[model samples]
Target: MENDFEGRPSSEEAAASLRDLGADRQALADGVQVPKMLLAALGGVAAWWVAGAAGANPGENYEPPTSGWLGLVAALVIAHLIRRETGIRFRKMGPRAALVMAAIPVLCLILFSISLGLGSFGARWAVLLTSLSAFGLVTWLAGIAFRSALDQLRR
Candidate 1:
């Protein structure tokens, strides 16, 4: 008599199927790179510009990086569009990835604050650094989030 599981695919077959799916996903990822980069860059610049208005110090007319709501909106919008257009496999991100994504912008804000306190470059340079760094961090974290989402699909 045949065992009930005998006709079922083996573990190796399951892994191979996953690899095939992963390759398909990789092909999709390759196709979206240009649009993704463009959108991310736009978000970075928009966020940097958004900070200029409120970040300004009336005494010296210097702007430092602050929480970037406008930029966040841009990034979130672009991220939504890209997710739809690219069809990245985000099957099971769970809590960890969600927490990381949530924390990245806050961490960037904290870093910007730290940069604002540095006196070595004076207020003007500090503001510039803070703005640029904050935007960079946002984009960097976006990349990490995308990669993490991709990783979740493979599992």
Candidate 2:
């Protein structure tokens, strides 16, 4: 006689299917890669924002650094480009990635503040150090965050 569940998958078949699905997820995760150029652009923008403090007039005639606004816009554009290039919009990048992402701005702000202080003291040349710091730190952190995101996908 024919079995009532003839059309249904057996337990072993179900397990195999699940294993294939897991392997597919792993393959997709491995295939996803962030573009290096975008990360460099992000670093450049971060450096520019911090470097803006060099030309800023602090104290008495403090003309607020307008480069900050421009930098924000540039950053947004770069982020859009990155998303478009990657095509993987992560809903949750895990806590490590989140922390690293959060740290980028904080680090930039610190560097900007330092630049402002140096500029105020007529140490305009020092802004270069801060700008370089911004570039290095931002680029490094961005890479870490991307790796963390990839790690999340592996799970």
Candidate 3:
């Protein structure tokens, strides 16, 4: 109030304030580091889910994999841990991040289906490859998505 000229800031002052805010956002985004444990946990969960296919019976009388539910629970726990570790809760991680996140589950499902096929053919050993693939792919994609989310915060 003491510094008010005409009960409001000048246009230049407003612009400068906005620039400062942007810089602050950028700094906050830059300071955020993705937790390695979060990535590994997610990757492990994905691998476990895909590996479940190796023991599943594909045809009639096939029982749904109980591992799916366990994996979902693990994922939820990871999400909570990530929030606590990061100290930032992202409201929206941007379109690219969203797409990458979506792709994770889709990729896992594809690998799981392939694993099921291999199991049906008695090639259960091949599921290990799919499980490893899921681990690597999920971890990489999760990193990408986290970076993209930070970029959104910078904006």
Candidate that would win on lDDT: 3
lDDT of 3 at 66: 94
Estimate, for each residue in 1-155, the C-alpha lDDT of model 2 and write its tens digit: 98565587989999998999889879878898767889988999999899899988889878877788898899899888988999988877899999999999999999988999999899999999999999988988888888888888877
Best by TM-score: 3
Give the alpha carbon lDDT tens digit for every residue of 115-148 in model 1. Answer: 5455424555556666666577666766666666
- If scored against the real structure, what TM-score would every candidate get? 0.57, 0.90, 0.93
Error of 3 at 23 (Å): 0.1
lDDT of 1 at 42: 48
Query: lDDT score, residue 70, model 3?
Result: 96
Model 1 pairs whose backbones collide: none
List model 3 lDDT by residue over 1-155, tens digit each: 49556767789999998999999999999898888889888999999999999989999998889999999999999989998999999999999999999999999999999999999999999999999999999999999999999999999
**Model 3 TM-score?**
0.93
Per-residue lDDT of 4 in model 1: 64
Total clashing residue pairs per candidate? Answer: 0, 0, 0
TM-score for model 2? 0.90
List the candidate numbers ranked by lDDT, top first: 3, 2, 1
Q: Regarding TM-score, does 1 or 3 come out ahead?
A: 3
